[model samples]
Target: MKDSILRLKSRLIRTLKLENLLFKFLPNGIYVFNLHRIGDRHSCQFDRNIFSCGVDQFEQFLLLLKASFDVVDVATLSQILDEQQPINKRLAVITFDDGYKDCIDKAAPLLVKYQLPAAFFITTDFVGSERIPWWDEMAFLLRQSTGRVFKSLSTGQDINLQPNTIEKQIAQVIFTSKRDNNHTLVQILDDMREQFPQARAQLAQQSNSLFMNWQDIHQLKDMGMDIGSHAKTHNILARMSTEQQLHELTLSKQVLEQQLNQPIKYLAYPVGRYHCFDQHTLDNAKVAGYSLAFNNEKGKNRFISERYSINRYCFDEGDLSTLKLNCIVW
Candidate 1:
């Protein structure tokens, strides 16, 4: 009973951020970590939730990773698993998702400084395009809405935009509206734009260079980083038809290979939750010609069965130490 109380207290402390003792419970295996955006968290008006770390804090996290774990590349990790070796404690692999600009502008320089290898998964359609992600656009619209009550055109629901609750409002919008693709969402954004024209005008002035283009992707590849597919579009695979999943998987790989002149052996499922991918997605990944795939599930990769569902601990929003602890797997 005393042991249970102690464990409960530990969890309470970690959950409430009174202390960051979460890493104390880690298991022995490859600790694959994922990051999305890597710039100043409050710097963007879009999705602050996606910000991993600022430049200096990111460097501190890198130092922490170096001190705490044996960092390796994805290919090395695959080989280690293939050889049927014993799982090593804190065997780490760093990865970036969503092809965000900060992965190139901010994270890469520091990665070079530390001489660490990482994989980057790119959403092919948005690279070199003026398109902002669905979440970002949703945040922008929600935050930009002047009315106290947001009448959602897509869902035909009224969302209360309480004072100083833009974060909550964005969350509500995304929860109700998220889907496999933005086909229906395009009209929703347009409807929101009609309701809020000033925000739409303001959005046009923001840089379209938010995502890394083909040239910048080439530049990162030149830096000796591994490139893989996030998908053709950043859509949830399980929410898609089998044909759609196949198209997203195969076409993204084909495009990456064509552009980079190398075999694209890795894939990180779009959204990467258990519900985000089905068995169909896995079969299609094999048919798409990927050797391995990653998902942002919190667990240890202790065996070869996890090749398709490679688990990763991820950090998006928090202080450096907290983010570091959050990135450690159990």
Candidate 2:
């Protein structure tokens, strides 16, 4: 029954440690964390309990945010939110969306073994795509369909396909309701490629190399790591048009500042859901200059928030006390 109420609210927040007494009334500022894929959830092909988190639960969520927090960098939380300063500690930022290949083979070696400093947005046409992302090709054709049931020609709703985990929760509820409707997710993947034509040619012969290239994003910007822009084909910027959301936010920030020569500030919108970005996608991400922009709106971010819709907090592969009661209730 909802995994016994999330294992009794993760054993009452680890038996009342309550994240060190809710880390003393939180609210200092910035706590952005939105990861995707770490590793080895039984050799996950995709959707490992919603995009992944293993490698020792991401090194115990970076040792519980380095025993309290202050783990900065996105240019020091954009110069402490452009100088409204006053965060007397408890700052944290570490982001990652799309661009997977285990964010350069297993979360950049545990973010360089816990020195920690991440950003990594990038969907720039899946870096050097062979094409493995229409929601991991609809969870690899509903986990290699041997056929149990399947209907949803855009929501007629049959869906009883079970190869366990109720067929990855009905292929993540029909690929998150046709991923913000890119023409109804290309007409339901062209009617699931004419009804799974050889499971869409065995998901187009697999190996899309699971993302990350351009020399693994210039070796994650020579290991300091912070490369943004999750556009250029991650789509759903309020379903495009404002010149295709300013050409997917200025050509994925001018091709990641012309192949990582630098200066590609930030952005994380693609399916960063609150209707997937609007208000002309935040005035075309501040006329494509972009100092900061993120979504997936959950909570925690201040210095009067809203540098183009800040808010973030999403982690998967649950149960480190439900990721410490979602960082003490977001």
Q: Which one wins on TM-score? A: 1
lDDT tens digits by residue: candidate 1, 105-181: 89999999999989999999989888988788878867777465778765677777764777877877776665424
CA displacement after TM-score superposition, residue 303 of candidate 1 (Å) = 2.8
* Best model per lDDT: 1
Report the lDDT tens digits of candidate 2 across residue range 139-250: 6676667455767666567876676565466556555664535356766767766766787887677665778889998998899988999888885778667888988889
Off by over 4 Å in 1: 1-10, 13-25, 153-157, 179-191, 205-207, 320-330
> How much lDDT does each candidate structure score?
0.80, 0.76
Clashing pairs in 2: none
TM-score of each: 0.87, 0.33
Cα deviation at 154, candidate 2, in Å, is: 34
